[model samples]
Target: MTASWTVSQMPDCTDKTVLITGANSGLGFEATKAFASNGATVIMACRSTERGRRAAIEIRDSIADTGATLNVRQCDLASLESIDAFTTGVERDYDRIDILCNNAGVMAIPRQETEDGFEKQLGVNHLGHFALTGKLLDLLLENDSPSRIVTHSSGAHEMGEIDFDDLHRERSYGKWEAYGQSKLANLLFAYELQRRLEAANVTDTLSVACHPGYAATNLQYRGPEEAGSRLRLGLMKAINAIVGQSAAKGSLPLLYAATARDVQGGDYYGPDGVGNMRGGPEQQSSSEASYDRQAAAKLWERSEELTGTTFTFVLD
Candidate 1:
């Protein structure tokens, strides 16, 4: 039988606390709404405090009957300093974190460096979350049941090949290539984190990866102006009109990874439609490189070293 999953199949998140990065818009926003509506305390972590607060208010207005609360916090994923501040604040206020959804990302933007002097894509999409997750590992591990970490990857990761020498594209830069590298890093992080957790016998913490497929999100507009010319943007809109799934639908795979009882560590979730792009949530596979155990291990080591954050749980 084919594996099947949908938002409706998810268990109630009542009394749970989910912290979602970039929860102000797109799939992140929809996921926040879904979790909060199910009675979870939803923390909306956005780069913009204004937008985050507005999103929180919108969720409250829409789900008044659920009696769920939304908390807004500022976190610019491109800045390590900002990430530190955000995590410190969260730790001070929240006793435990039930779920952490690393869903915020940038794609197809011009070559630029983050405040920390790393490539913007790699910094924001992968390293930032890496640092954040490392900092928050204590709270995540404190839970009695499995607390989940869901990294948002992309199907484009199939084309990614990491270049350790030029990870920041100091020699040459291509927007899509950088984006792909970041996404691939996300999958690698998820898989490797699971390995570490298992080796440490921390079965109560699960790490999974997910993709939203081709949903019509603001990420599509990250290209150059000419790249998003009227004709191309119009064509994209036309395609979205015909086949684009709702953001809520796009978020289902993440919800499954975060809450489904049967989901296992390192499992990947995505849409079940053609090319895994436009249907409900289902267990999915990734490129062979994404599953390379050796690479995952090396990447994990490099990530810890580069970010200067070490996990207390050491893999045997």
Candidate 2:
């Protein structure tokens, strides 16, 4: 792994179409800029078209023209209907997608249900992206060159479990616990997707997972602000100022996973700093549970049932 890997090291991506969810702010926004600047056509899939348009304008004005096209499309991952509509539109307009970054996610927030009646964090973070990836799998496989699906996870996954008995936390819910479980689910889904891709002999498609480490992003404030806890929000802001890295630095792992030539199908990338919390991108092992094939398979089956979207791949 290159210890000094930066976005500038990204390979020429002209004509490659990269789709990123939650591209209006934080890591997703930074990644959008990086991919566009490197000559990739970027699609900003935001929940709010207004916010997505604003972000697109900001990128167009801020980034030097690189012949990269930036398009903002409406996509609310919290709703399966919205995901379907967004993907349908994407399929209508584009025949191939070179990269899909499942970067949109909800952090530790108060217990709430999505439009689909699932826990908010799990729904938006894991299941939503799961459905999105499954729906877009064909577009990814259509490209002649290798295409990648980069799912953003976190260090919180280390403390998580499947909790199959209480998958939705309907019986009980803790903010951070649910967040950890969702992130762990991200890893499980990512690894499982890679395995399925391999079994199906799809050599040109890769499913990789990554983490931004402890980057100061609006993600931290969403939970506190949602719960109306000013104290918690303030504390999060302080922590971000003191301990978190810049969003640009934090997004390196995602860029690496998306564009790095050396990346394998199931590789996981994160920060190289102590505790995997900050610094440049580096390949690293995920938690032991993330490698549980049985758990991953079970989660995948349940996800298909919940989302009503089945992956098109036929596994051996």
Scored by TM-score, the top model is 2
Q: Which ten residues in a row have the lowest lDDT in candidate 1?
A: 1-10
Judged by lDDT, which candidate is best? Answer: 2
TM-score per prediction, in order, is 0.94, 0.98
lDDT of 1 by residue, 26-90 (tens): 99999999898788998889999999998988888887577677999999999989999999999
Clashing pairs in 1: none
Against the correct fold, how does model 1 do in TM-score?
A: 0.94
Query: In model 2, how many backbone clashes occur?
Result: 0
Q: What C-alpha lDDT do the candidate models reach, one value each?
A: 0.88, 0.94
lDDT of 2 by residue, 1-316 (tens): 6668998899998999999999999999999999988888998999998988898899889888899999999999999999999999999999999999999999999999999999999999999999999999889988888899999999999999888999999999999999999999999999999999999889999999999999999999999999999999999999999999999999999999999989999999999999889988999999999999999999999999999999887533
